[model samples]
Target: MEEWTVKVNHCAVKKEKPQTDQLEFGRIFTDHMFVMDYSEPLGWHDARIVPYQPLTIDPSAMIFHYGQSVFEGLKAYQTPEGTIQLFRPEKNLQRLNRSNDRLCIPAIDEAFILEALKQLIYLDKEWIPSAEGTSLYIRPFIISTEPYIGVAPSHQYKFVIILSPVGAYYKEGINPVKIAVENHYVRAVKGGTGEAKTGGNYASSLKAQETCSQKGFAQVLWLDGVEKKYIEEVGSMNVFFKINGKVYTPMLNGSILEGVTRNSVIQLLKHWNIPVIEEKLSMEKLYQAYLDGELEEAFGTGTAAVISPIGQLSWEDKDLMINNGTTGELAKSLYTTLTNIQYGKEADPFHWVEKVSEAYAVK
Candidate 1:
């Protein structure tokens, strides 16, 4: 990773930072952003961190028509000691490259990009809210910039990273949420770009998500595209269930995202000697577990919420209540532990938290 050039924002007027209580998700952005361009032969160059401004892209850009875009989400935390840190950010960047590969976009230099991200975070460290359950959300995205687009890959691309100070993902705090099982609509297929962190996959899920919202559900529980019986994941996160003292999550079957929070929960469960398995989990089996009085808990893990307990799951007008429609013991434990580690309230036994200064400096 090399040094990144920084251009200070000299605008006389600046947007006021929102109050900690008023910090909502993705609504407010920081003052600076990182950007880089890519083209054939020259590769990725002109790396710089400039003031946050609107982008001017041609209307005929390939990204506008072909939907060739990939993005990754992560957060920077302001510890109680006033230091900024990142949790498993390298994993997000690695997944970004994977998405790039799947979307036919150019792969990024993971280490260099990581360093650039750290520098950008450090530059806008004040944008990281100090309130509990709040942090600076980092969105790194790549869009195809080629104006003439047909069906093939584009030769030009732009990668940009922006920061947003976000409050809690759920307005009600970490309370359990109701989810509606999506039986008619499928989010992804096995042989498609399901596993990639791209916009199209999420754009395809909006209709189903909107339908669930009208039904008074927080999110949609997606089933497999082929069978529709096998569980895949929930909207924007990975799903997990506990039955008979054992935790189970749907395996990565080339159709579900490999979430960093999901992996961390699995590792944490195993470290505590809890039985955890990654396999093909079916909704029918989960419903059967509920019938047998063994369905103990259910939750969704992601960067946004970290751990969102699922209190009720509705399928075909039948609802299955888990943990008496409250946050489960395991879910609470996982959320507390993960947030503790993120905020530097507890020692990171897994060595996942990376301080900004060390991450920016070379060995």
Candidate 2:
């Protein structure tokens, strides 16, 4: 992989480090970021790492009007052995390209951008939180920069990467969360940008999420837009259910985000010789399982939360509780296993953790 040029921040102003316990997700940013530009014929150029600052773009940039943007989230962990590592970063890059294709953004050179990311991470490696359950959140995004907004794809764009030291997704730790099944509003339909990590899909979900929040729910479990019968996913994570000693999740039906943690959960389950299935799971079937006392547990998987146990699921005015509204055995095991590998507490048999060596840490 080709290297990205580094421009040291001569006027670097380091902020006072917040107490680890006071750390919030996406609240505090590091001192530097990686940036690259794109334009017709020129392609991606002028890649460099610069001090974190406000961006200056045309007010009429297409991103402000047409919503031509995409983003990806991943984390860098400070291992117990004092090494910094990332989990399945290539998968995030691959998904970023998929999102770029869907949003008419030019595809980036995966290897090159990944190398650039590592360089950026190494430069800001100290920003990675060392507290338990804390890590550096990485946000890589692209936005349309073309000034003209005549309802066409932008010819110019900007790709940027920023880092934030995050504590944890849930303050309650890996406890169970309450979810409200959305029936009135749909997040995305088939043949839409559901699979892509674009801002529009998330923006369209805020109303539903707001409604669910007012009802004392943490997130909304989205059903398919067409029939509204089959389960799709949570607002920000892929969902899984354990019924009668078997695990099942909604299949990728062109309307679901393929989460890296979701895939890891499936692989870990299969590795343990547990039966797992990916298919269209209906809310009716889920409710029936609950009534029959077969629904053992449920959880949501994502890069942010990693493993969030779902204890209460409200659908059609019925509050169905799983595992007595507590984190189940399987959910706890999966969380422990996944975090162990991420924090270097155990051997990474899956080879998911990639190290950012100290050599690259020096500018």
Q: Quick one: best TM-score, which candidate?
A: 2
Query: How would you encode candidate 2's per-residue C-alpha lDDT over 197-273 as one tens digit per residue?
Result: 99999999999999989989999999999999999998789999999999999999888998999999999999999
lDDT of 2 at 102: 91
Off by over 4 Å in 2: 1-11, 170-172
Per-model lDDT: 0.91, 0.91
Q: What is the lDDT of residue 206 in candidate 1?
A: 95
Error of 1 at 34 (Å): 0.3
TM-score of 2: 0.97
Count of residue pairs whose backbone atoms collide, per candidate: 0, 0
